[model samples]
Target chain A: MSAPAASLDAVRPPVRTIGRDGRRRLLAAGLVAPLAAFLLFAFAAPIIWILGYGVADNELASVWPRVSAELRDGGDELPPDEAVFAALAADLRGSQASRTAATAARRLNYALPGGRSLVTQTARALADRQEPDPGGGWRETLIALDPAWGERETWVALRQASGPVSAFFLLSAADLRLGADGLERAPPEQRIYLAVLWRTFAVAATVTAAAIVLGFPVAYFLANGPPALASVAMVLVLLPLWTSLLVRTGAWVVLLQDQGLVNGALMALGLTSEPVRLLFNRTGLTIAMVHISLPYLILPLYATMTTIRPELVKAARSLGASPAVAFWRVYLPQTLPGLAAGALLVFILSLGYYITPALVGGAGDQLVSYFIAFYTTETFNWGMAGALAILLVAATAILYVFYARLAGPRGLSLG
Target chain B: MTARRTMRAVSAALAGALLAAPALAQDSVTVVSWGGAYQDAQREVFFRPFEEETGIRVNEETWEGGIGAIRARLASGGDPGWDVVQVEAADILLGCEEGLFEPIDWDRLGGEDSVIPGAAQECGVGAILFNEGIAYDRDALPEGPTGWADFFDTERFPGKRALRMHPAVALMGALMADGVPKEEVTAVLATPEGEERAFAKLETIRDDLIFWRAGAQPPQLLASGEVVMTTVYNGRIDAANREEGRNFAFVWDGSVGSFDYWVILAGTPRIEQAYAFLEYIHRPEVQARLPDAIAYGVVHREAADDIDPERLPDVPSAPENLAVSVTQDLEFWLENAERLTERLQSWAGQ
Candidate 1:
């Protein structure tokens, strides 16, 4: 019985070693698994969690759970019923004791201009007070501590912010607020973010168009010129890309300032009597952005242009077409993919530029990303940062969809 | 309110956490502060000497400065990785309430009288004092600007000027320039009409203004002749003058001044060493060394006795400089930051 079994076990070695193709596939997956895990945890997860904060309404409710509960079940009362007040009283007492009242107050303040002080002041006033009943309920006590608590607006803000989910930040991104009656325009004094969003788009488009115009000739020369010249030119184009973005922006500052090299040269050449206002305005911003983005446009355009056969344009010219018509009809269409890819690249990169503009451009010329940085670093308002980020991602996605539609089946590809 | 509650609530939980805490290999205390040149100066003045004098292994790290950073570190476990941290004034107030910091023993720091007014807090001791004032490149603007008024009067100064992008110092400076008394700047700013008044003053200079975000940018802006005058940290102007021989003159009139405090994170095992570190920094000798390294004022007023009398007027805490300066009303800004920021941005966009 043992002799046949022993022979079968020895033959099973080939099956254990497995197929060569399967082994290769396993090795490839093993090599890529670390990168895949890194992208999931470090990159994708944080992005999703941050984006979640854009619409999340957890701050106020999480800090004052009892108040959130009362609001969820409070029905259609103006200043909310006495039960809501009692719940708020209990919640504030607990939050105040835990020193989390300020945290809850901060979220409320995002909706109401002076809500932070109001909530903290009230909580502090009630710090040592016993819980009130029907004999003397919290409605009177709360209203006395701050008369704003008696107002319908305060209750409404609380109700909206009492959330499993809410639209406060998302709506704010559009320069709108969530009123009891749905959406409302933000106050005139506060309606700047929407304009900032538009400015971001405008700047990105300007940079993209400028880069294409400036880069196309350079790209054409690199593609059609001698191979040795193209290699040297390629190195020159990538030189700026190798430097820190901040350094490149700083170099622009030195070149473009009122007393800087460019202005000095212009004055010496008798181009102007005085230094033109080029350092901290849209003009300067466009020039610096174009300089930084030109290489990106040139690289891709050259890649696609090199692939186009010169014989196609020559054939069109031989068929009795004018040189301009031949170039436009035959040669230009072939480079469209790269041209589209370069524009998309420059536009998206320019959209997120904050440091360059913040350092070199005037306050009026700042993009939406500046405000995102402002909120994240300066104000510590993560919800607002998340809102601006979501606005940017959404706008970029929509633009990408539109660009893809226009490009059609040939599509945009970074060659 | 927050300090008392946070201390009680967190201390109770922290008591149990300390039992599970692991033993350290050395008697080292890590202190975190704002990085760059400021931190380098701190190392030379406070960190290096403290290690030699007390034999406590002083470990140092730098942060970009945020309350959120402190909150994350302390909330991970009561024993925050770093022991003593230098935090902004608002963070001291906010963190105290959240119980992220250990309550200071004023007796250990030679009592509350040892420090300047507003330097002593329930949970923190003031580590450094800074002032933001109008600094003009003397070469560019031959007639140096005297105050925030000249800064706003573009016709008089005759060129673009840079102001901090934030409304905190800008609003106070604007109110002072608009003729509100230095002491009453925050009081007037608390009212809606006063808010509009400050913005109106800023509006006068909006076209002629470029905003700066970083402390280092203002000096660079001046050096580049991008602006004639800028609202800049006094220390930055001093550093530029000393290092680069840049003739930038700082005007103390209508300056906005604030403090950065040293706080011990709650439940740190190095409580005694943390106290010793705080005490060491407060010593008049140690405090005197700071002003020479950087132009910032020493927290201890008595440190002036050791400081060169000639250098006294250059600091924010000097009576002459303090008289003209407005201590930044952190509480007022904390309440209205969002409103003022958006309003300023809206005005700028227009």
Candidate 2:
């Protein structure tokens, strides 16, 4: 074999002399350049921007950098000197005139609720002033304007909020907070995010499992059946994919409601006496999510299954192996790559599922994405939203790594 | 290939020029509001008329209620999209204090006293009065729900109840259902025991409750019989009855009346145009046209006379309806919304 290859290579044209290899490599790179740049800007940039919010604490730092620096140098304990106060007064005065006092006030309010008015009122009072006198009665003036300025907690909150990076959002995401003594578990009332995270994972996992169980059989049938029948089946499987997820979810809502088609049929057939509460609960969420995710699982599985030859299973069966044993050992092993790919795809997609769950699922069935949406669109807490999103992405990445390790490199491909 | 490339370039430039064409003309003001009939009414009563009176075009946009979009826009630094926004009272208060909105010149748009009492704020002019009230499908539940108490009384009006998935109105409903007087709802919500009492009252009907976040959901829920009764915006229920031929009746007792205000974004070039639109809507005649168009109440007190007397009962600010309704305390919501929402979410998830 080596001698024949060598002889063949010796007879081949000297394409290397024309710089063909470099030109081919250059062409490949050039072809992918647009895609790579697109991915960088559209995908990686947004992820970096969102992840950056986890540590990017600038709302207060931008306005009162001097006060923040002083607070950081003086430690967590509130400083008694008028330097911090003077810095705050000067920042407030500048911010007020520039119309950015509200942003600073809002930032402070996040740290200490109602801190907004205190800052805004003080800023308005001092809007006419240009400078903060170090020796002057600025402290008394500030204290008189808002008694909160005299408090130590207020100072601590201000210092904590004014930072280049803080674990406030990340810790809050984990239902932990940075207390006086450092990181501690949030109070029971505040410990909601952890449960939401767990619920999100649980819902995603259940949907993935359901997709696998329901999709595998259909994919197998499509792969092994007669070509004409298989083509028709494939079209049926892809039909749901053609419809919008919202429209499909809405269809499910109509089909599963109390007086809807499903219940109406069930009653007509004498299957049950009463209409089951099926639309806004865990059952409804699982059904809708599994339906939405089935195509993701089926396409990949079908792709892998089609590659498996019938002769392999026949060969095993002819060797006196039982049909189930032969199929499991020969056919199932071949489809492992597809199964892993499909499961992971379904899992990842389901993890970020929002619309179907929001529309069909009850309040208890809501996932972390719901809260992320609430914070992002309803409360405008980008820090909290970013933190939750980062947690979700990290969780998905970790899951992918774990799946990759289990499936090996070849199994990672979606056929 | 070169010819095609040049063609592409020429077309791109032409498209760009076409896009920038509007920039040279009279400036257009972007007005954001809750979409559907409400926006339609505003377009008919305010936007078109304002545009006709002044050559400044009014660009209409729709937003589901929240200050988050405005905050996101502002956070990105420059221009916050819409010039004039329709905001809830609590959001307006918060946005005004934070300077997200430009302070209204009450003098220009009829003095503070000229608008309905409590409708005028430092940065917002009250546009319309909307109510969150019990709405029941008359055909579904013949013995319809009368108020929050009847809503909570499942034995009397037994069905799945849809409530707004928020702390403010939900808590108030719970308190009223628990027999707390309308005036004392906020005072009771202020105390820990009051909060606990409200939650406990809510707990009784927790299993039968289906929560809706958007204003559009409640009427749909009622019409589909998915929920026999639900807390819905007064105008939405009215629209459903009028348009869909659904016999949905609103229960005014224990209804929470909240005002939607027209707020000007802080740093928009069309601030003058936004103020002009706001002033135009503040006119009694323009305010009166709103009720006939959408069945929502006008904030201008004198506009009541201009409204059809036969349609008065349907308006949220109607004398009979207003008598039984509790005005939502925007201040209380502004201060406690965060804490209460967190608690509400935790409870809801459980």
Candidate 3:
């Protein structure tokens, strides 16, 4: 077998193992331990805490020891919780406590919107009831009454419930199920976030795909072209990065607005009857995003393509392959790592993007990062915001894993 | 052997406590505020004066980064970062709800009479005053767009308008456009139908508006003629009109008034110093200098007397401006902010 002769040198380890190996290994371990500890303490621990905070109230934490012990010793979970509910029922049933019940009933009545008196309804149920049914579980009772229950979902949910952490938030981001009972459903009055999440993904993916498709050919041309022209092409790519992000986004707004430069030019050339609604729509969003992120894709792809030998295509052609076949089979395969890197890079960057989308994108065009910001700054709902961030990170991690698997070991070099 | 180990652990804790003894004893007060001109003015008028009067050192911090930064410093489970924090009135309400801020001692704040009568007894003391108003390009309009009514009359105006897409202010503006009386805003918003009505009203000019979310964009958009008019911070408009030579005019009519206040965070170590700082900042002479620097109003009523009438009208202290502005119901905003913002975001995103 004609094994590649150069493989022998590549197989050799750069450094030999000796007395120094243990000291080197020890130093490396020492260096990494603090980093790992810092990451856990600073980043991971807080994230876990934030995720746990959604369902776990501080009062629950205070009672955790008793609660856990009771659960472990086979004490009833629902009965104690239902005891509170029964006490609430009893309090509501008491004629003397009618004012409080009426007040709560009035509040619930407002929510129901012109429905019959809530207190009267509760009274009827209480009058009809024999004993308050505290079932084997709170889940069972909540499910029975709500019918959003008894689905075997919460048990699987609890197991899948993740951590001191959860996927409830990520599920909430898409307006999906946290459990059988605890779905993050938008009210009938409010619009669903599931569509919003889908729209955001579609917009981001479109922007990334557009950038790749538009940027790839330009990058290829620049990569294979003469050095001076290549430098000029590189300048064209680098120019936008030097400008402020707001400035670039603003420029797009000017170019795409109803009476903007592009429309004015088009009108002057008699292309259409009126200016187009280009500035504050998905078109404007994709245009601005692609303009800004195009360089990100091109630079990586150009770097990868430039390093490929021109002779590979020539060699393939010389070996009896057609020019198109030679180029596609020989040259294109070499650039897979770059394409993967650029696509993933652009996709992830586009997902968390804020300024460009905010500047040029309309209300419907904004991505999920806008909501993350909205929650953090406006609502100050740190838990929800943290949960959204965790979801984005999880989604990105899953994507990276997916990409890594698709690309194989050598393609992992893109990272 | 285990008992000895436990004893050692207890001794180490005691040593750690002893190490922190001097810090516990020291009469140091920290005040946290939004940094920039505001911080500088507070340092000059409030902290420096208070420190000078009492000989207690004032440590100042900025609210530029993370809220957790403040929380973590406070959660050392002892003395917190700030004796006083300059928080938005809505944030002060939330902080009070969560037990994050101390209740103001009304007697300590000069029995609610020394400050503006209606303002002093709230969860916070009004420190800086501002209003949300329409800023229009004078050159573009030709006929001046004077009020929120004119702002929504896109037919006459016939130009793209921008508004800060913040739910609270935007919804309020929509209600004003829908002709809800100023005093009834909170009461009206309390009802689900009223909220739906406001959202529906905003949907009218939804296409015409280029929703600006950042503080900087409205002014930039106005200047660039991308938006001929915008609802923006009065100071941003005032600064652009005066300094940038932008042909702009701000109409205070139907503008919602807002104020930033100083409040003591709960469990602060330096309550006395915080009180001292508050008293210092509200002094008329000390408060008068702020309008010249930042163009926002100081809450000191007497401070307006020193400011020129021409200047005061454009400043938040102006009597004309005050007449046109409505006081924002912070408590109402506080209770409804979360659910309202969520709904608003859902609607806006659609």
DockQ of each: 0.58, 0.32, 0.18
Q: Compared with the true structure, what per-residue lDDT tens digits does model 2 show for residues B127-172?
A: 7888888998788778787888888898887789988888887999
1 against 3, candidate with superior DockQ: 1
TM-score winner between 1 and 3, please give it. Answer: 1
Scored on chain A only, each candidate's TM-score is: 0.91, 0.91, 0.67
Model 2: per-residue lDDT, tens digit, A169-195?
788788887554556787676578888
TM-score of chain A of 2: 0.91
How many times do residue backbones clash in model 2?
0
Q: Least lDDT summed over 10 consecutive residues: which range in candidate 3 chain B?
A: B16-25
Q: How would you class the docking of model 1?
A: medium
| Candidate with more favorable, higher TM-score: 1 or 2 | 1
* TM-score (C-alpha, index-matched) for candidate 1: 0.91
lDDT score for candidate 1 against the true structure: 0.84
Show model 3 residue runs off by greater than 4 Å.
Answer: A1-171, A176-184, A235-278, A315-326, A393-415, B1-30, B43-59, B65-70, B113-118, B266-270
Q: Which candidate number would show the highest DockQ if scored against the true structure?
A: 1
lDDT tens digits, residues A234-290, model 1?
899989989999999989988998888999999999999999888778998999989
